[model samples]
Target: MMPRPPAPAARPRRMVSAFTGLDVCETAGLRLAPGAARVLFEQDRWVFAALIDAHRMVLDRELIWEFAEILNPCWRTVAKEILLALLAPQHEAVLECAHAIRSVRSPRTCFRFLQQFTDWFNWLTDQGVTRLDDVTQHMCERYLEERHWSVPVPGEPRRRLEPDTMAEVVRAMQLPVLYGELLSRDGCTEGFAPWEGKSASAVVGLKKGGPNRVPAVPDLVLQPLLATCLYLVNVVGPHVADLLDVVRAEADSGQDLPRVTKERVPAVREVLARLRAAGEPLPALSTDVVGRRVGRYGADPLTHLAWGRLARMAGASVFNEYAREQVLPEVQELAAEVGIERPWARQAALIAQADSGEQVPWTDPVGDEDLQLMANYVVTACLVLTSALSGMRTSELLELSVGCRQSRSVPGGGIRYGLAGRLIKGKRFGGVPDEWVVIEQVDRAVALAERLVRRPQGAPLFGSVGLSDRVKNLRGWLERTGNREHWGLPVIPQGPTSPRMLRRTLALSIAERPGGLLAAKIALKHISVATAEGYAARPGGSQRLFHAEMHAAEEEHHMKLTLQAFRDAQAGIMPAGPGARGLIDALRHVDAQLNEAARTDPKVLTDDRHLESLLRKLAKALHVGPANFCWFRDPSKALCLRLAGTPDATRPLVGLCDSARCPQATHHRSQRPVWIGTITTIDALLDSPRVAKGEKTRLVPERDRALRVVAEIDAAASTAPAGKD
Candidate 1:
């Protein structure tokens, strides 16, 4: 003011431009004059409002500030402050670059920096990092290095990048120092100490000259890994599409992905089945068979062995391991005692060699004494193997019902029941009925199933009849009932049995048996021959014959006896006569006593209390007591003897009544009433010389009538009042 601004310092007239000339005002449709500029500025603020609206769509809202810095360098200080406050240090560099591009007076300088910044931004976006702070310098460096790295060229002596010039151009750009810092933080630095000096090129192993090679995996290990993957995919259940994509990618890229055919699956199954059957630990067959069957596909024994090992490692069963360890040793011992060469001795030795730690083979033989102890186990195993070998599952075994039978229509003869089974393995197959089958083990299983049937239609054949406690205790019972040596059977394996393994072993056995192929297929209810064929190829077929013979006769006898006893009980309770009358009368008397006591002393009349009291009295009286009522009627004498065979038989009967107002009262009148009767016909029958002449005969009806009259009188006296008019 003092200087008067020196005539406004010869001020040049300020240029008046259209608001549209300014990008911000142009975007907002506003004017540039001071008065109108305020309104235009406010209108331009709506752009920020629109950004807020678009926030969700933008992966990184921080990028908007950088964009702002690039568009208006005069706002660089504001943008820098906003970026520093909003983002990490790495992001600040990006914003600075953007600001430099916008602020540069030369158009060429501005264009060059803009191009560099844009390219860097696009790369960060591709890496899923939106903020400059999020994209580490190390990552950017590694990315550029990856792009430039030369790969081995097939049929060429030297290596080269696919696009040779592209890497050089990218490397020439002046990338910010923060790029390297970010990369170092992310552990992407070339020759990083922790990375063992592996540059990006070295890590990827890109070279120029040789054919593209894939790594190889041992077949044994590969099979199990593949099987495990399959199990995880199929049994555990996961995203199939995602898993398949991964597998497909890995396979196409020649990664060590597992490959298995349908044939190989069964072979693997057989190996696992054998290990399970033996109840042994898995062996390392992968090392032995890796290169033997590289391209060929079928049942690979080595693959099977490897799978078994994997299955065990995956916690298949401890009992399985115990079985394997115990079975072979026992078998060798038995073979030596019996002077027979161990047929599977080499197999046993292989197992021993392959065993790590306490793993051993079980080889004890079945004995007669252990038969009952291991009956359920043996029977269940046989049934399961029979089905598995035939290709049947547990569900099918459970679905069997009574009357689900096959009948053979004999030509010009009556239909005979051949075999009976409900839906087996979810399929229907007509065959010989279990009753007709000569195999005792099978018959026992069938009988058990029949016995457990609750409905006429069907019943759950296994684990339906008994309590879990009882089933669990079956192992302990086996231990006590059988010799220790008998616990180890080549087929049965040592240790506790599970329903699952039993079924598997059964399948195996059926597969190995002669004519077992068809029989197993029918038993398992399989739709395809191939499915059943897997079971038939198991190792323990010959053992089944022994099982069948060992159990058939004894189980049949036990079953017969059990049925006979049940029928006898039923028949015995059906007859009506004096015997039935006596039992009914005794029960009625006990009930009356109980009811009276309950009425008098409610607290004292629990079921246990009454039962205990009644049992004690009855036991004392039966063993040693005053003979009171003679319930036993002597048919020869036709006498209902009261106080039978007692010295007081002829004494005057004492009638103690309950009612106080009775007229024929005596000293014992207050006492409760006890019935009075006499053996009137007994005196004459005993005194008669003719009857005593070493002869016995049924009494006449007159004598029976006389006894009946006395009994009726006694009953009346007990119920009616004394000296009734």
Candidate 2:
């Protein structure tokens, strides 16, 4: 009988405890051994456990080890220190410098800057510097001169610091210390060194205001400018290189309009030269000269002006009326040509006119009813709204599964929706399923999803219809329905605004709500809380929920009881049956071997022969056919395996005869199984040298046999089905 599969192997039983461990109470809490402490930590304070994990890298080793001996101490202290350092003025520059240094992928290059900063800090301390006041202009100049630092060269081997970086660093370093005082009246602290050779006032002046501000692009100007950029990206398309060459040629030629040519450099250069020259205190080249050049070239005046505007912008002209006018019309024409049918186009036209000295009416906020109507009228509105609300990119939103929900608890106690999304910006908020929105907004969306699952697998939940095509159809429908005029909000003329505004509005609104910017940032899915904090116009009430406040005490108690029940369900450690212990041990051994094999060469463990053998043995144990199994390829093989035989394993495991008729089964049909167990009663017929007496042999009851069969089937099928068949 195949040598009885090497007699299987004897399983080494693990000892389990029934008695409670001694708990030593201290000022903070009772402490237990590492294992018990872990259980306690996970049960009562998972957030603390998660915080410890997150800051494991920065935590002091000795303290961590001590905590590890009993309970994992909160790592919040290290995280707080890191945050404080980041916010400190002197450290802010160092952090920025560190970021810049780290941005260089090459280890050698990154190390150079790291060493430089370390040296700078050490030198400052050595000089007995105390407070921002001690840093001098001479010191700053000397540091720059010594380094011979140059501006960053984009996409090059040699990385250099930006020209403005030093000034920024100096300014950033001038802010007052966040925690430790650098220059006390009595003396400086050993670790706290102040800046040298500069007065407090000078440092204060540097830190008081924000960095040199770029002139704000007027709203009227911004619309036209954005439109122009889009128009250029679209119209020029593949010929952008050629267009750049043409502009460069014009700039070099120093003519009003260089002769149009296949070789476009001279024309481009000539145009750039004229634009730059115009910005300078150059005497006007008489109108006659301009006219002559225009006439000879047969060039359209408006086109030349548009091109000239583009060139001026390139040369960094802060303000130019001519450039503004030229850009708007070109953008408008391009929008029309590209078949971009949106109300924003009309807005763009109006904004352009306003920029060109035309008076316009300011529009009020679009009403909710109007927005709802717009949603019905324009299909794009839904796309935009979904994108905004979900903080997903247009592409990502389009790809979203209908099953997505709003909330979920991660491995840690961290929550993943609402404020988290606001903070992170564009990415999906965790701790929530995607289905949350569908459940909340429109119940039909979920029904539709269920229907679609039967119709088509892996299709986008929102629209299986092609996006651009649907957009076009929706646009036509909106025009026919007359919803456009009905819902259209009269606002300042702007470029092609889409549902993106809704997302921004949502973000801003969330920021304005309780918890203010931080909450909004979390909702928007921003990466940094600080980034989110910046968006709030004013601080709002506390919106963040602590773990203790989340659930009712009764509910928490119920959960603990439920967890204990689950543990009890799986508590029995007896060997299942004859050879069961050996089989389990052998299976475990094989698993370990496979794991090691995977480490060495993943292909080895994946070999068809090894898999087929395992599957065959598994089939024999479960008494199931191999054809019943199917593996999915996309996400994970293990998950695919679990979903395969669900239909066949349901009834017997639940202790119901004909589970279809059982009320409990029906009630819990959709509810996931929490735990599964097999209870077997074994009887020894003979203890001595094999003499089977008639009285010694007891008949096994049909119920017991049936239960055993079901248990065996389940054991073979574990990890092969998510639910019973």
Candidate 3:
């Protein structure tokens, strides 16, 4: 006690002052923060160059946008931890951690690790964590259950991290051990293996199927959109082409149409008002689409621009839609053909009632606007057809160039169509040129789009009409199609028509149908089979949707069979076979699980888990076999199969079995009808008068065998265990 503890060795004053002055939390050369001090020279420089160079977009844009002000809080806190850890004698371990983070796939991922780790470390700080060595596995788990992201929706309720998000947090916390560099570095390894034997399930329960889960587009929307898309490509598009050819061939050269000037503006506005007042559906045209329509629809009078497309095309006068005095006769005829009932008719009637002395009841129908209106519909149709058949996302569809069609024949017979384009999503660069294999429908739509898109253009196949505007117009097309008396289909959708829904619909069909994940792999262009398997449980887990559904369908079928057996048991209609007791045991297990659920619900089984458990028990021995019901089709248990010397056949050779003697055959109440019918047939066969004594001798033994099976089944049922819940 007297030997005054050698004054605790002094810290280097200059280094302490430098560390105190610096913002150590900032990430400097991937040292957890961009501006963080205490940077490792060669190690940090390489990581900085790799991260900013490789994962720039994820870091500079997406990550920043995702976590704004809260990001600095994360940076500041983690910086403090790094300063403390590095100030210790052994600083190389922390440097190793920095180098390992640079090894992540992208700068985005590297930053994400930094962010999540900071979150964990900061929470640890509150829990009084002085160094990384002080961290514990229990503390890691508690952080998983209790951590929340910094970003919050203004007025929405906030909760702790979701199970999937928590799983990512666990991954981040465990990264130090996961990366080989962290382990090999020279340092004390006290807390290095805190999560060595643990799994994600040990920390949190998984969640499945919610708002984030992709759902198939409804059939009503899918059908009409498909039909209309084809119609536009195969039918209307050709008509528009034919007209353009005729116009160009006319050498009709430069005939001018009437243009509205300042003096004619009042009259033009009157016609527009009349059209609106008459209750017709107005087109939802974006400014760009409206501008295009003015030139193409000859409605340049409304645009007020003297040098509009329609005006430019005429080379002189303008064909103003409003100035066309009477309703165009051709438009009225087409309207009648489509059964629109001329919304102008009602307005004309109202005008007649007003009767201001010089006026007769008058109507002005759609006029030159008809052709352009149909053109808009055709554009949406083309988009729908291509989008649905191609399985391209919205961004990819928009990125499509005018010449995005490619087709070739492989060694196989079917012609393969590939849509040439760049894949934009998850691409570090401006995506690479990857051609997607497509169906014939998509090829046709692409051909039509090539013809329709304005020449002298860039990458976009569809013009500047935005996707939101297109989706809105798509719904309008359905409403107009469904309400039209000329159309027979009642095909209005009660849902939205976003590109996402169409892609999801195709995915659901591929996953749920007879086609498996391999089919989805081809359609979605996923490089790995594992990517398509993500469609099963959300966040991509072990069980795929196809396998889960297939198992479910099999179980549902078996349960129906089991319920029939249970009903037969209740009625005391014992089956006539040697395997009856096995089925009786199955019925007892079913009663036990179902009764437990029935106690609370009192109707159908409300507990899925209990039903699943019951099905598992029933599946072990219940194999539907020919002739007699076989409880165990297992090769080792089957007398016929064992005698024939086979190993694990999927089904038994029932015709080869000794039906009356095979121990695996379980006779049930449902089988009673078959036995009764069989015994009647046996009696008939035995009574045939034409039979010789020798033939009857052979028949007598077979008849005796059938009767013996019936006797054994009755005896077994009588001695069977009584079923109870």
Candidate 4:
């Protein structure tokens, strides 16, 4: 082996001021605009956009790294140099700092870490630590301890940081150590290798699999919430559309356009004539507004007429000073005759009928504010329906546009519905075009949403509002007494809900059915069942339901049969099969328990809960089949296992099960339908001309067996006294 050369000596400790002339962006090899000047370590801020492509996340105001927030100029310069090294190419970083950049992928990642880093430095500053090199291990450990239950923001209450958040804080501390050589001497922490070389995740003890902390919306809240939203979109939507059309037609008729008094007077008189004929009152202020004007401003209640509404209806800008003097007296006389109650001239009467048979008007009076509020409610309903049914993320739903609905016919004459939208999750540069297969309800909701919020073709259907806030507003609207009582909507249970929760809820609901694992995987667009399983097993998700549903179904089927048999025994019906003796004994045991319980309470036999517990053990032994119930207490006598030459098997193979002759199987009234169907099938086969002698012989025996089972069931039913059990 060759001898090695001596290692180079470390650079001497120095102040960040010594590196003032360094062009940090150029050193990091960041992309730059044409002829842009270099960003130096001396500056208090770094405008990263001047050096690279526009960031997708940061707003225009956040384009720059404002090191001024650090307060100390020396610490600011050191912070910039350390972050610049993190931005360097992997090879460059390895050459300079002797460590490869791992955590940060883009400037946004570094930007997220910056705030926590600032908090830690601010805390250090408060401790009277003047420089990074003076940051001792004791101080770093103490900061971690304090942050475990500290106020995250200035005015917020104290909270223990979640595992994910604590991990981020630990990563912030480890970054300085990773780039210690790249930082000035005073910038590096004097620690004994932060956390003793443990990774941030290990130190914080984050779970191995990504544990989705977002919970599914509980069924109690989701059921009525979706029901009310569906009512708005499917039932109330057309009325809103018609009213909006009327509103738009009046607005677009050029009625509100500027016009001379002489040209508009006849139009105003014509509107009055129509209102008089229809017996509609002129628009007026509400009682509260009338009182406010009379008491506060001392104006006559008669002068509170909505003259602006009249002017717009008559193709004039407003009821001007001259026109009001001319029209005021005539309007006052008409108001006194007909009375002014509603704000709108034409109302949608009886929009919905309550369950108690009360006719509900769309609204008492559709004022401008009221109309807008109804329209907003319609939009909120559409949003809720679309999110719950389609499981689309907020970003994807916001990317939906007008006329995005598409449909195609399936082979079975069914139409498959889909909505065209952009997938905003993985694709960064203009999102990838995708289509979501949805139910008919979501399609109707999208249509209603388009009508509520008018947008041109290909324009975004919804605005970029926070989904959480929108859902909160929707629940608030539903809680209003006027809206609830008038609309006849059910009470929406209170709980936190969001787009992510809706998505996870959809995943969980689908995963709790038979053959639902595959359905959930497809519906959620997951690449594998394992991924869907993880979603179903999330914290506060449907883990219990997903695991227990299949077993519960089998157990429920057994319990039903066991309970029915006991009822038959009470009615003088008896079992008659190879396994009849065992089934009769089990029924006798259930009867004995009921008799004992009835000693204390005469109604114990009628109690379903008490009966269930008594019969539960016997129910577990009953394995239901198509034509028989296998009392599978002992696997040694299982006909299916014996025929398959595996008598030690824990479960019987249904295909090989000869329930008719099995000693552990019994037939009852419930099996009568299967026996009748079998006989019908055998008779059909025997009557066919294609039957050979051997096939006819086989069919005859099968038909006879089915007839005998049917005879036994009929005899047992005939012997039971009518109106007994």
lDDT of each: 0.32, 0.31, 0.50, 0.69
TM-score of each: 0.17, 0.19, 0.43, 0.63
Residues forming the 10-long window of minimal summed lDDT in candidate 3: 9-18
* Worst window of 10 by summed lDDT in candidate 2: 623-632
Task: State which candidate, 1 or 3, has the greater TM-score.
Answer: 3
Q: Mind giving the per-residue lDDT tens digits that candidate 2 earns over 414-490?
A: 53332111211222111122221211112222222323232254434555323344435544543554422333422
- Order of models, best TM-score first: 4, 3, 2, 1
Provide backbone clash counts, one per model: 46, 77, 15, 2
Give residue 486's lDDT in candidate 1 (0 to 100): 35
Clashing pairs in 4: 31-51, 255-315
**Candidate 4's residue-wise lDDT over 1-725, tens digit each?**
99898543344444443345768666655667887766777777777666444423345555577888875656665567567656654434334665546433456656766777788888888898876666667787898888788656887788777877788888887777776665664555333467787988898788865545667788777777777787778777778877877777776775547642755777888888888888888877644455576888788647567676778767676766676777667777788877766465355568654335477676667655456667887888888878877677776777778999877776757666678776655443235666776777778889888887777887767765365677677767656526766677767777877877887666555443222222221342322233333235343222223234335545755687788888888887877667888888878988897888789775635458788998898888876666877788889988888889999988766557676688888888767887898999999999999989899998898888888888877776677787762
lDDT of 3 by residue, 275-380 (tens): 4556443222233445676778766323322223223233335545553333234334333333232221233321211112233332223222333455556667
lDDT of 4: 0.69
Point out the worst 10-residue segment of candidate 1 by lDDT: 663-672
Positional deviation of residue 328's Cα in model 1 after best superposition, in angstroms: 54
Best by TM-score: 4
Candidate 2 local Cα displacement, residue 262, angstroms: 66
Best by lDDT: 4
Per-residue lDDT tens digits for candidate 1, residues 88-171, read 222333343331222212112222344445454455556666433343447755766655545657886654455434432342
